[model samples]
Target: MCSPFTSLSSPTKAPSLEVVDLWFRYPRSSEWVLRGVSLRLYPGEVALIVGASGSGKTTLLRSITSVGRWIYGGELRGRVLLGGIPLEDLPLDGVRRSIQVVNQNPYTHFIEHLVGRDLLSAAVHLYGKELGRRVFARITTALKLEGLLGRRFFELSGGQLRRVAVAKALLWDPKVLVLDEPLMWLDDEGVADVVEAVRVARSLGKAVLIFEHRFARLLHLADSVYLLRGGILHSVEQDFVKKVQRSLRLSRHPQGGSGGRTTGRPLLLAEDLWFRYDKQGDWILRSLSLEVVEGVATVVYGTNGSGKSTLLKILSGYLKPSRGRLELRSRAVYVPQNVYLFFTEESVAKEFEVACRSRNLGRLCVERGVSYLRALGVDVDLEESPFNLSWGQAVRLAVAVATAASEGPAVLLLDEPFTGLTYLERLQLAESLVKLGNTYVITTSNSENLALVPSARVFKLVEGSLE
Candidate 1:
């Protein structure tokens, strides 16, 4: 195999994938999401694009696939080239066969209920069963997904789903592979697996492009790094990490002293809790006990499939425990992993109004909601649809709404709230959470964010038990 860098000086050599003078804007929006952005990716190399939330990184990725063009209803003026041939000249089937994309959300790529069926469908659709089976076996082994074949797609944990999504894409054996936020929800071990998988793909001579906010973890693996900002792409030296670190360094919030030990009684308590989605299925939680003190944040750290989200749901009264006693002293506001789930209204202001009204907070004051969001480093137009906000913005809005609903000391439950947040945004969120002075039960795979709340009680959830 030849090094991708060696061919860069040759004018006759064409890149595996190239984007030239690209500009795009969604329908009804005057602003262009991508402005005169161009990129080149060579075979046997991995490239990375890093940007803040809503910086058009995802939009650029969507443009490559072109399958969701109609859904976005955007005007695009760009030439996306594959091996020096314009994408417009290629047949749709040919384009699909040559370039494969795994979206930020693994669930978006799932077409079948069972993992085996999903992999088989991708295999059969791309290649005949005989050849597909051979390819599928290789992908499964490479991704370490042997035991997951028999499980249902929905039953798999976040990390498992991400691996399966990548496996499904590999079944097509595309020449170029693009992944959006592949490292978002992964734990340390999961991150290692993904990095190894990327290496394996590069070793196979595939051009790989990864769009991520957490570039530090994947920076070492990237052959070239580009920073996307203000809708423009800027090539940066491989020492991009130092530049990003300096830019994202924020003033540390004053550490509130350790949440003093409980004196009278715990605000929330669970004893010998047991839960499972199915009667005969394996228990997601077993004999797990927890206590949440008033006005103290509790951080639950765990890898995927460790029941962190399940425990939060049970505490929020969204899901009942299969057995054991669970008690809560106050109403808990549950913010799900997908922040969009918390929005029932069309616009951000309307959603806040609904939350205020539902919580019986008297007259609805949208200003309060706006202020809350602004303090959390989310400064978006209130009239904009919540659906249009970026992932980090939506999470901030959701947290604001949850905090607004609490008239007194309350319990706030958040599951993976920092998924798409930038370093500065995470710091802002941590500062806001500290100021709220409420009992927070938050789950995250990010250990760095935990330092933001030094006073918070921390627990590790592993194999249905809290330690």
Candidate 2:
């Protein structure tokens, strides 16, 4: 079989990027995250790096951009060459002009509150006002971001944020582009838009490197695929997707239905629900009504910016309905899309202890917490800081903490909980949710996640109404 990393023919032009015998570790850390990793990306090619969470994919990207040395406070020993010149020897301004990176967290790139100003600021800073406007106009039209320019950054949905981040990076017209989890937070249509943007970049002879957990959707567009594991990189065949599929298969537990009491009546009810962020603003949800029964899983599905998250917030009592009636039989533990917001404790164990203490389940806290973490397939050290966990691990930890808080029967609301998770991680989460046997209300844009609860009452949210 041909290696995915092998180029069709040696390019006449110099390679856009070259990593030779790279080795790196975080400050004061004895273990190296990347060891002797080497790769070459020529102009007009799209390369993909796939790995499980915490497998150093993000670390490799940071190393290429020299962010590890300056911002992340990491020690590095190796050479990163760009355009036939070593990165350390290149001027800072020259490096910045030649390479543009879009981070995994889009929120970190926002400098202006409004979308148009945020995008314009970067363009103007780089190319000056007159030329920047032309560049912004061209890129926004290409990415179909014209409609979002007038909105506030906070008002944009997850998919919109991802698009804007890509557009911002492309507006600079760098020689190399790096995107971390670019396909995340996007719906099917949004994914197509990003894929097209990548194609356009390659057509312009720019090198592109993407770090993604879900690469099946982008496989056809990638010129090469590399798997990062145990601080090493290896080329893998496209057929490796079969392995990912097998990992995603849901497990059938013998005791799955034994604990669930599905005969109970509805625990939460919504009638004539209507909501909007502002009085004059467009209604996000209108005349939406639903019933959630105990021991039953419920999924709300919609496209990007379709108010799925908004509905979850309303159901969880975080946002008041402008006009509606809502009845809850018990308290709810709501976990937002950004799970980090719910964390207050320094460490995972402490967070679990606090949750147990709040519910007066003192003696059982440690035992229950460890059990929950195991169920979620989280193997991180309990003493490690919660912030230190990767995105996928942190999300699983948040779910475990939320479940622990609901000592008795309660409603568990999770918004986009499967954002950064791998296929196996998601499968583990599904099994854990089934065992919990609580009334679960999950909102997601991914159709794949709907299968997590086969028996879930699925509802589609369209144009402010549920169907």
Candidate 3:
């Protein structure tokens, strides 16, 4: 069944599978992302496609939907049929009614001030008036979003927004659901929630396809696995899923790093820190105090919007604390959330060299940059614009550039470092981070999901205070 994967010019059976030599390239990109890719989807089947940065998993999903209708440059070479009818000939709206795509960035979907406004309003617009309050409640509860229906949109964090988008998509009940990096910001429990959602859809005989970099929680959930690389599809068995964890690891946790010691002095200290966005509102960080001792990796774990990122920002001097004394043992360098900004330069590699030289640590930071970039697989055209690479490549490059700025054991506050990274890239990065002698304070929802890092100590942000 794995060999000689066939395509369909026309599909008529229950397991309607049809795609003939599909090819596509995004308007923003000059290089081809997908090359003659073909695959079949059976009813009630789940497919998990994994790939490194620039591997083209996302393009496959879009080609099926012809999302490039907004652009007129891409060349379409093949036929895509569902139940034996050509998709290209069908009305675009009719095709869309059968397939739904959840974008990688949900911020594009936010328009209203409150969660109910965004979701419920969408339901009314899509289904036409008279969706009873009871029906909406039932739908929200099915997606585990009942508690969030009334919350303000600005109040909802990244993870919360992701779930809200998911709930809204489920209301459509399309024949196929395409999720792009669905588990990026979810905690272990939240991951479980998404898994259950997929399971429910599968049980209803809907075709479920997921695109993710990390497959630790997703490997077993899929009936078939596929790897997207170099514009090709390699149908793989479950064995391919398990090897991903090790294959991507430059070195696993216990074996990672040169075992540097970082406890001589404090890099940053927070004493009775109180912070809030609004002067009249409750403090996001309530009387929180912490220290980043040298040569250690301190992990901060908390539910959505619990001040993990807030505290990291305050300690890094990105956001000044509202009250209480704060001190930095050394200069701090922060990696911001929108990491793509770092890739604007003409020469990606030269940017690192320039940053290191500007710091004038001159040698230590420079050497770290050389080794770290190699470990993170930053081996593209150094002279090209950084935005030319894929999302995962951009994320890893951001990590390399930010870490190269270190000057004498400074504090590094990483806010969700593994945003779009694949398992191998993440493991290699975890190795590089553990080896850094500087103190690290990372804010994450699922710190253990990586399973490849050795977090020194974990902190919990409960209601606003870090305990």
Q: Please provide TM-scores, in order, for all candidate models, with all chains considered together.
A: 0.78, 0.78, 0.76
Q: What does candidate 2's lDDT look like per residue over 154-218, in tens digits?
A: 88766677778877877766678898898777775667766877776676567999898867667
Candidate 3 per-residue lDDT over residues 120-143, each given as its tens digit: 777776667675343445456655
User: What order do candidates take by lDDT, descending?
Assistant: 2, 1, 3
Better by lDDT, candidate 3 or 2: 2
lDDT of 1 by residue, 264-365 (tens): 447788999999999999999999998888877788888876889899999999999999999888778899998898899988888888888887775544
What's the true lDDT of residue 264 in model 2? 65
In model 2, pairs of residues that clash are none
- Give the Cα lDDT of each candidate: 0.78, 0.80, 0.68
TM-score of 2: 0.78
> Best candidate per lDDT, number?
2
lDDT of 2 at 307: 94
* TM-score head-to-head 1 vs 2, winner: 2
| Runs in model 1 lying further than 4 Å from the true structure | 1-13, 24-32, 65-79, 107-137, 149-152, 184-190, 242-266, 271-283, 317-331, 343-361, 364-374, 377-394, 401-407
| Ranking of candidates on TM-score, top first | 2, 1, 3
